[model samples]
Target: MKAVGVIVEYNPFHNGHKYHLDETKRKTNPDCTIAVMSGNFLQRGEPALVSKWARTKMALEAGIDLVIELPYAFATQKAENFANGAISLLSALHCEEVCFGSENGTIDDFTSTVSFMKKNQQAYDHTTRQYLKEGYSYPKSASLAYSSLANHDTYVDLSKPNNILGYHYVKAIHDQKSSLKAETIMRTSAGYHDERFSHESIASATSIRKALFSAERDIKEIQNYLPQSTTKWLSAYFEEYKLFHRWEEYFTLLKYKLLTSSPSELANIYEAEEGIENRLLAFISESTSFQDFMEKIKTKRYTWTRLQRLCVHILTNTTKDQLKKINENPVATYIRLLGMSQKGQRFLNHVKKDVEIPILSKATGFSDDLFTLDQKAAQTYLAIFPEPLRTQLLRQEYAKPPIRFNEEQQIYL
Candidate 1:
């Protein structure tokens, strides 16, 4: 069976995502559509608005034949590591193609950019280092370095959020020297970080989230931007949880983690670099909220997103030593299915005998550090909720099977 893979974090599965998924299928037209989705936490270091299962239901219903979790080791990483994990998984699964949405939709430019960077690798590294020394944030420094290398023509604007991620995806494809063909589709309506709705039906997830968490708190305002499944699942999660997952919800927990650990201890946390632990110690005490804490801690070197990612590491008690060991292999060790449709199940059965890696349906019995970290991520995410609800959801981490979507029966079985 021909399989096409997508790397996603359907935080809530807005219309923009559906557009990308539809466009990817149209472009690839593979027999099986597989998605490697982030679980509980996301790439930006923010928790999902709902749980992974809720988002998995959204994907399975939307059009993806199969959904698998991107292990926490990869899901919460920077762009390069994130792409490395997702692309490696697709390659390991024997996918024929991998598609992603990007501001620079054309695949050739990304290919060219990778090749260009490789050719100017030393010079690019030096320039990036120079910018970093001068206190430019990593993203800005990278973009400036790319422009410096291009001189007159920067083919793939390394500046845009999607473009940067897309570049990394292409780079991973080539870096790993995988056989999977790469493709891209131009972003249609919304930008990645737009904080307010500007389109009728297509809005950035950020904007949709902004609306949902706004003072007005109008869920209906963003409903048009979501598929019915996403709407239903999101509403249900909110109703039961009584609040969406946001940094603020975990602020008290994070504060405890921050204050209790000594500066030397904080130095061991992943992404807690350059004496930033001391800075965090100095500012965290006076800060009133997550936003306030972040503002006080922000510097030219650490972007808000970067800082948030660091917070995720701190919140999860992920250490530099622990992550180093897990990433020694780099690629994920197994494929953990989150959900599957009838087509997906058949595709898996056909491919199972030939698959190189283990395909896990149940969460129990995995003793690997990667799997342990994934379970820990889910447990940490649940910690935000109160007793009964938290315990109920936590049980699923060990006992729940991959969700089954019966097309003929028209229900999850």
Candidate 2:
């Protein structure tokens, strides 16, 4: 069976995500749709508003045929690593195509940019270094360098969240030279960082999250744009647990880890480079809040988001060695099933014999690699939430309902 893959956080299933899913099917008409999703943490260095299982159920109900966890190590990383991890998973799953939402919807433009970067490596490198020396953040430096070389201001807009992510996705596909085809759907309505909601059919996940968490919107109102199963799962889940509030609950443990671990040990954490270990130590000593610690350590060379991810890596014990090894063998080796429908189950059966990666349905206490790391992170991540919420997360998997799509539901575009 032909399968198309999507790399998503879903953070909460909203109309925009539904549109992407529909568009992917319309373009590719793959028999199965697979999603490699972030676990409990997201790429932006924040805890997911809902648990991964809940998000997974939401995806399954909305249209995704299968959901695989993007290990916490990659989920809480910068765009390059995040794209690498997600693309690796799709490639491993033997997906034939990948469809993503982009501000610049044309694949030709993305491929052109990729080709330019590949062929002008030296100019890109020199310009990047010069920009950095002039006190720009790495992302801004790279964007400026690329724009200068291409004579196209488009690359400079990489500061925008979706555009930057799309650029990385294109880069990863080009770097890997994979057979999988890449496609994009035009972004509509709400922008990625926009804190407000739009009246259009497509709504940003940010707006959805805000609405779900605020008293201004009721659950029933939010339900209008989400799949029924998502509404069901979230309604049940929210009743039991409050979403994450402050970042300080994890700060004590993070400080303890930073203080207790040797500088040599800190050197091993992902993104730890060129005496960053000492800088982290200094920040840990003086800074109290998570935001303060990030501000104290942030430099022109490093973005605040990137530094936040590094802190998460340290907190999660994702070492530089681990990052390097994973990069070397980037293919995802396992599928940690979050949720699936009956059709999805049948699709799973068809692919089971030929799948390169081991498929995990139950979170057995046995694995020791990335899967184990994911489980540990999920357990520890829950501790930051309030009382019964923590308890609910610990016990969620045992009682959480799986998503089941109706047979009569429209599958074709």
Candidate 3:
């Protein structure tokens, strides 16, 4: 059976996500669509607005045949690593094609950028190091380097979120020489960072999330931007959990982690490079909130998102040594099934005998170092939610099976 793959983080499945799914199927006409999604934590280094299970349910309901978990190690990294890991999983699963939404350019445009970067790899590296030496953040340094080395206006487009990820997605396919074909669906509506709604049905996830968390906007208004299934899901979740979580909710725990940790200890946490720990330590006593602490630590060399991710590493007690070990063995070790439809189950059965990675239906007998970190991520997610719900989610991962739906059972969570 032909299968197409998508890398996603449906923080809460919005209408735009549904559109993308439909478009991918319409364009590819694959027998099945597989989505490898971030769990609990996201690439932006923040907790998802809802749980992974909730988002998995959303994906399955939205028309994805299967939803697999992108391990925590990959899910929370920079764009290149994130795309590399996702593409690797798709390759491992034997997907024939991969599709992603691109805001800046067509597939050929993204592919050309990739080719340019590859051709000028050495120059790009040298220029990036120069920028880094001048104390710019890695992302900024890379963006500036690409612009200079390519000597073209379009190269600057690499700085945008969708373009950067799209570049890396195609780059990974090229570097690995994988057989998976690449495709892009032009972004139709709300831009990535847009904080307010334009067309309700096509609003960005960022905007939808902002509206969900804001006290001023009526939560009922959120129903407009999301699909009926997502609307029902979110409403049910909101009623039970009281409120969806945000990274700010973990600030107290993060502050405690920083205060209790020594400067030396902080330096050893993942991403705490070159005396950043000392800077973070200095603000431990003075900053009262996550925003305040992040602002105090922010510099030309560290973006807010980077600092927040560092904070996550600190909270999760992920260390430099631990990450080094994981990075050394970067190939995905297992396939985590988050949810599936009836077609998805059949697809899984067909692929099971040939798949290289272990297909795990539940978190049982799995003890890889990376899988352990994934468990830690879920636990971290649980800690942020209220009591009964946290316990419920924890149980759901181990005991409940992958969500399955069919014609008779329209939706099951």
Candidate 4:
């Protein structure tokens, strides 16, 4: 069966996500659509607004055939590594195509950039290092190098976050020589950072989260941009318990981690960089909040988001050595199922024996280090919740079955 893959966060499944899913299915006409979604923590180095299970349920309800968790390490890394990990999983799943939403890009555009990068890799590397030596951040240096080598305006086009991610996805596929077709659905509405609901059925997830978490608690505004499935589940979820999580909520623990840890220890965390440990130590004493700490350490060589991820690495005790060890192993030893539809179950059964990695529906009986890290991530996520609820949610990760939804299947709503 033909299957299309998508790498998603779906922090809270919004109207725009629904539109993308619809367009992807229409374009590919795949027998199944599979997703590798971030769990608990997101690429932005912040806690998700809701649990991964809730988001997986949203994806399955809104038409995804299968949802698999993108383990914490890759999900929270920079775009290049993130794309590599996601595409690696899709390739392992034997997907024929991978579709992503790009604001102003076509498949040819991404393919050309990938080809250009591969052809001019040596010059690109030299130029990038020169810029980094001159103190430009890795992202800025790489963009400048690519534009220079390509001898065109590829830089401006690739500077956009979504387009850049799309480029990385195509590049990953190209590097692996995987037979996965890359497709892009042009974004038709609100921009990525737009903090307001837009006309028609489109709205950025950023806007939805902001509106929901604002002081006034604009429930109607949020409702307007969410699909019926998301709205129904999310509304009930909100009424029953708190449904918002922010980086600020964990700042205290992060602060303590930084203050107590020695410079040598801080330097060993993933993405800590050459001199960042000293900068972090200097700022930890003076900065009052996470934002303030980020501002004090931010430089042309390190963007705030990069620094934020490093902080999360520190908080999670994800060391550089540990990351290296994990990377040295095969790319995803296990694919953890999150949720699926009846069609998805059939798809899994069809490919189960042929799949490259172990397909796990539950976390128990797993001794994989990567899997252990995923559980650790869940533990950190649960730490933010209140006492009894925290314990309850922690148990749910191991005990909860992969949510299955179908016309004939009887399951909890």
Candidate 5:
């Protein structure tokens, strides 16, 4: 059966996501759709507003056939790495195509940009460093360099959060030389960071998040956009668990790790370059709050977002060597089932023997292939959960309740 894949972070599934899924199905007409999604934490270095299981259920209810967890190591990373991880997973699942949302909605433009970056690697690298030396953030530096090469200001605009990420997705697919076809749907009305939820059909995830936490946000206001299953899951999860409100709790540990570790050790962490270890140590002593710490270390060469991701990597013990190794040997050797429909189960059985990766439904014990970093990351990720919720996470495997998509499916409203 033909299948299409999506890489997503349905932090709290909303109307926009529903539309993307519907459009993807309409365009690809795949026999099934699979989503490789972020778990617990997102690429932005923040805890998900809801649990992975809840988000997986929301996907299944919203028409996704299978939901598999994207390992935290890959999920909370920069654009290139994030795309590499997600695309590798999708390719492993034998997906024939990938559908994503982009503001430009032109596959040709994305391909052109990727091709330019590839062919002019030396010139691009030099220009990028030149821009960094001129006091621009890494994102700005890269943007300026690309813009200079393109002889147009448009490349600079493409550096905006979503477009940069979209470009990375295209690049990853091309670099891997995968058979998966790429298609994009134009993002309408709202931009990624828009704070208002005025758009009736295309409200941004940021706006939905704000509305979800606002005192004035009523069920009626959200009911029109969210599926009943999503609302039900949110209601239950929110009542039992409190989302992370601060990044300060992990500060001391992070500081200790930085100060005690040698430059050689820090060199192993992703994005650790030139004398950044010293700067990281200097800021940790005075800066408070995740945002403040990021600002203090922000150089013209590195954006705040990039620095924040670096900090998260350090805190989580993800080393540069580890990232490099993973990238060099990018493959999804195992699938950790988050949630799936009955049809998904049948589908799993059909591909079980043929799939290259081990498909895991239960999280009882760790396998040899599971790295020390993965285990450590899993432990750190689970530390934020409260009591019974925390304990429940450990034993959740015993009660593997699969979602039944055939009965729970809903069309876009």
Candidate 6:
């Protein structure tokens, strides 16, 4: 069967995602579509609003045939590594095409940008490093470096959020030397970081999340911006967990980690370097919340996303040595199945033997370090919840099998 793949967070599936999925189907026309989604923690260095399984349910209900977990190692990484993990999974799934939502919808522009960068790689590296040394944030340095190279040339703009991610996707495809064709769908209406709703029917997941966390706003106010499947699962999560996740929930623990750990030990955590440990230590007592802590910690040199990622590492206790080993040999060891539709099950059964990598449907008997790290991530996400619920959910995560959606029955199994 022909297959197409999308890299997604689905944080909670919403109308904009529905639009992209529709357009991907319209464009690719694959027999089965798959999503390699982030697990409990996401690329932006934050906990997902709900569990990955709930989000997977959202994906399956929205017509995605298969949903796989992008391993925590990659899902919680920066742009390049994030793209690497997502593309590797799609390749492992034997997908023929990979599509992403981007500010620049034209695939050729991304290809052109990739080709130009490859040709001038040495110069690009030099410029990026020099700018980094001069105190520019990584993303800013990249944009400035690209401008210096593409001086008079028209290419994909590296400044826009989606476009930058799209460029990384294309670059990963070429870097991995995979045959999967890359495609893009132009992002509509809401922007990636917009904290407020922009359209009546479509909104960025960020905006939807902001509303969900607002004191005055509630889930019902944002119902129109999500699919029924999204609304249903979100309500279900609230009903069961009695809370939705936000950074503020983890603030106290973060403060404890920083204040308690020695500066030397803090430096061992991935992304906690260059004396950031000291700054984090200095602010721990004075900071009132995660927002306040981040405001105090953030500078032109350190982006909010970067700092949050560092916090995630601290929360999970993931070390630089651990991550460095993985980065050096960054092949996806296995693809963990989160959930699947009937079609997805069939597709997997058909392709499992021919696929190059292991397809992990359950983690009960397994013992891979990467998977263990993912397990740690899930536990950390659930750690904030009280007593029996936390214990129950953690048990359920390992003991349960990959979710199966019965199209005919119109129910989850």
Computed on alpha carbons, the lDDT of every model, listed in order, comes to 0.89, 0.76, 0.84, 0.83, 0.74, 0.90
Report the number of backbone clashes for model 6. Answer: 0
Count clashing residue pairs in model 2: 1
Number of the top lDDT candidate: 6
Pairs of residues clashing in candidate 3: none
Q: What are the runs in model 5 whose C-alpha is more than 4 Å off?
A: 151-157, 211-225, 244-268, 285-288, 365-371, 386-389, 395-413
Task: Write model 2 residue lDDT over 276-315, tens digit each, in one string.
Answer: 7898897788887776888888888777777777777777
Which of candidates 4 and 6 reaches a greater lDDT? Answer: 6
Backbone-clash count (model 5) = 3
Error of 3 at 112 (Å): 2.4
Residue lDDT tens for model 1, 48-84: 8888888999998898889998999999988988998
- Write model 3 residue lDDT over 1-413, tens digit each, in one string: 99999999998888888888999999999988999999878888889887777787778878888999999998988888888889989999899999998786478888888878778889889999999999999999988987776745555287778888988899989988899999999888888888888884789888888888788875677887888878877777778787787878898888788888888888888999889899988887898877788888899999988988888888888888877887775668888888888888888889888998888888877788888888888788788767787888887776666777662377563
**What ranking emerges by lDDT with the best candidate at the front?**
6, 1, 3, 4, 2, 5
Off by over 4 Å in 1: 151-154
TM-score of 6: 0.98
Q: What TM-score goes with each of the models?
A: 0.97, 0.85, 0.95, 0.93, 0.86, 0.98
Task: Report the lDDT tens digits of candidate 4 across residue range 144-242.
Answer: 877776644543277678988998899888877789999999877888878876666778888888877788875665677888778767776777776
Which structure is stronger by TM-score: 3 or 5? 3
Clashing pairs in 1: none
Candidate 3: residue 323 Cα off by (Å): 1.7
Model 4 stretches astray by more than 4 angstroms: 151-156, 196-200, 328-330, 407-413
- Give every collision pair in model 5: 136-300, 268-320, 269-320
